[model samples]
Structures are given as C-alpha cells and as structure tokens.
Target chain A: NAGVTQTPKFQVLKTGQSMTLQCAQDMNHNSMYWYRQDPGMGLRLIYYSASEGTTDKGEVPNGYNVSRSTTEDFPLRLLSAAPSQTSVYFCASSERLTVYGYTFGSGTRLTVV
Target chain B: DQQVKQNSPSLSVQEGRISILNCDYTNSMFDYFLWYKKYPAEGPTFLISISSIKDKNEDGRFTVFLNKSAKHLSLHIVPSQPGDSAVYFCAASDTMNYGGSQGNLIFGKGTKLSVKP
Candidate 1:
C-alpha cells in the first residue's frame, strides 16, 4: 500500500512565488502532518490535521497553510515563498495521535531562489 | 531555543561495529520519545520509540535506552551495516492535547551516521 505519498518531488521557485505540496495517504489514517527539514534543523512541524476538515498550526507555521478537505489528502501551501522556505518538506500520517504508528512520505525538495 | 538536541552532526563507523547516537532533551514533561531515520531524497521513518515508563526498548538489531533522570536517550544499532547509514532524528512529545489527539512531536537537528565497509 502507498502509505504516504508526496508529489512534486522537486521544485524551484523565485521569491514571492506560491506553490502547494501535495500529500495523499491510502492507509486511512486519521492524523497527518507537514514538516520542513533544513540542514542543521531537523524536521519542524509546520501544520497538522487530526481528521478531515480540520487543521492546526505547529511549531513553525508562518508563510504556510494547510487544508484537510478529505480523509486521504492533506496539502500544504506556501504563500509568498521566500528563500527562508527553501527546504525539504515531508508528509506523515498515523493511525492516531501516537508515535509508534507514524508513516512518512518520500518527501518533496523545494528550493526558493 | 531547541528543546531537543542532537549535538553530533555526523558519525562514522566500520561495518559490524556498534553505532550509538545520542540525544538530549530539556523538557522534563516529555514522556514519549521516538527515533526516526532518513535517507537522501526520502522522509524520516520511525525507527524506534520509548516511553517514560520504560528504560529501554529493543527490536532485533536496534535498541533504545532512555535515562529519564538525565533527560537523555540513545539509539544503538549493533552490527551496523552500510544500509543503516542515514540521518537519525530524535523526537519527543509531552502528552500534547491537540484537536482531541495526543501526538505532537518535537524533533532534534539529527545526526548523520555513515557505516564504512
């Protein structure tokens, strides 16, 4: 099964450009998260969803938005993309709010020039 | 300020040796800890986890040791193989209450482990 899938494996955008990172999971998980990974900074949660139609901010949510419109899809939107947003993004899901059941996607590497 | 820290940026060891990755946390409230492994061009995958109630947990070649008193935890991979080389991240959560769910993990910078043949 495709546990978690993130599209647009790689992208480069100029400052002020906008883009959305897509995440889809077939595991029917009730929780999904978006995190950004930088060289010296580990994955920092940008946003998360507990279930469909619900979303919340995480540690670093600035300049990014998320929507959980369906049980299988959670997309992360980058508004006014800046060089500071250049990093590898990951999408993860779990059956519930637990650490043991976390499943991560392949990830999308985004570069804002 | 980073609540969780993996001071070591990278580590290298010969194959079949033991690989020890260290992590420290400043949050005493953190009750659950997890270790995730990530390779180039991939997302971090859950490797192992431990709760405050446990001192250690092991699965096959991987083992995690937790010292609550010190707020420190470590992951040990015995007989390290080349395939095990990756960036290891340490994450923790303190019974977060979020949208009727309890899973919000704070992560460390990560330590890159390289296993040489």
Candidate 2:
C-alpha cells in the first residue's frame, strides 16, 4: 500500500500564481495533516482534517486552504503564492490523535519566485 | 515563542559510539513526546515515543528518556551506525484549548546526526 503519496514532487511558481498540492493515503486513517518545513525550522502545521468533511486551521494556515472531501484525500491549495511559501511541504496521516504516529509522504518541494 | 527546542543544530559521532540528541519543552501541558527521523528529500518518520506517565521507553538500540521535572527529553542511540545519519526532530502533543479539538503537535528544529563509520 502507498502509505501516503504526494503529487508534483517539485514545482516552480511565479509570485501570485496558485497551485494545489495533492495528498492521498491508503491507510484509511481518520486524521490527515499538511505541514511545511522551512530550512532551519521545524515542520509547522498548515492545516489538518480530523475526518472526512471536516477541516481546521493550524499554526500556519494563512495563505493556504484545505479540503477533505473523502477519507483518502486531503489537498492543500495556495490561493496566491508568495516567496515565503517556498518550502518543503509534507502530508501525513494517523489512525488516531494520541496513540498512533503519523505516516508522512515524501515531501513536495515548492519554489515560489 | 517556540515551545519545543533542539538547541544543537547538528552532532557527529564515531561508529559504535553512543549518539545522544536532546530536546526541551517549555509547555507543561504536553503529555506525549515523540522523535522522528528524516532523510534528505523525504518526510520525517516516527522513531520512538514516550508518554508522560513513563520516564523512559526503550526499543532496540534507541531509547527515549523523559524528565518531567526539567521538561527535557533525550534520545540515545547506542552503537551508532553510518545508516543512522539523518535529522532528528522532537515533537510534543497537547490538548486543544476548546471545542474538543484533537491535540496538535509542536515540533522542534531538527538536529542533523552524522554517524561516521
């Protein structure tokens, strides 16, 4: 099973452009999260979905939005790209909040120029 | 403010020696702690974890020790191997303030561990 897979492994975007980073997990986990890792910084949560049809803002949700229409997919959209958003984005899923650990996807490296 | 911190940006250790990575947290509400290992161009993977109820947890050559009083934790890798080279992140989870929201994890700046052979 592809534990977690992210589309568009790498991308380069001009400022003001928009894009969506696709994330999917086959583990049927109830929790899904979007996080961005900047150089010298820890991974910060951008958004997360507790379950299908439910989404919530995280520590760094500004300039980004997310949707969880189905249990297997949780996608993150950048409305208007900015250079500050250029970072490695990682998608993760977990069975539960407290007991299980997250299974993260190979990150998407986005460069907003 | 950064609630979780990994002061050391990097560490190098000889093969067959112990590699100790440290993490400290300022939040007392954190009840769970975890360590993740990440390779280049890849996402972080869970390594080991310890609950607040326990002071120490061990798995194979990796052990996690928590000091509740000091709000500090450490991950120890014994007889380190070259393959153990990677960045290590320390994370903690605390309950959401209101609305029954699931707890969120706060991570520390990772420490790059290089195990020389």
* Residue pair clashes in candidate 2: none
Docking class of 2: medium
Tens digit of per-residue lDDT, candidate 2, span B40-108: 988899999998999999999999999999999999999899999999999988754311343588899
Candidate 2, residue B13: the lDDT equals 100
Candidates' chain B TM-scores in the order shown: 0.94, 0.94
What candidate 2 gets wrong by more than 4 Å, as runs, is B95-102
**Interface RMSD computed for candidate 1 is what?**
2.3
State the C-alpha lDDT per candidate: 0.91, 0.91
For candidate 1, the chain B TM-score comes to 0.94
Best candidate according to TM-score? 2
Model 2, position B35, has a per-residue lDDT of 98
List, residue by residue over B15-106, the lDDT tens digit for candidate 1: 99999999999988788899999988878888999989999999999999999989999999999999999999999988654333334788
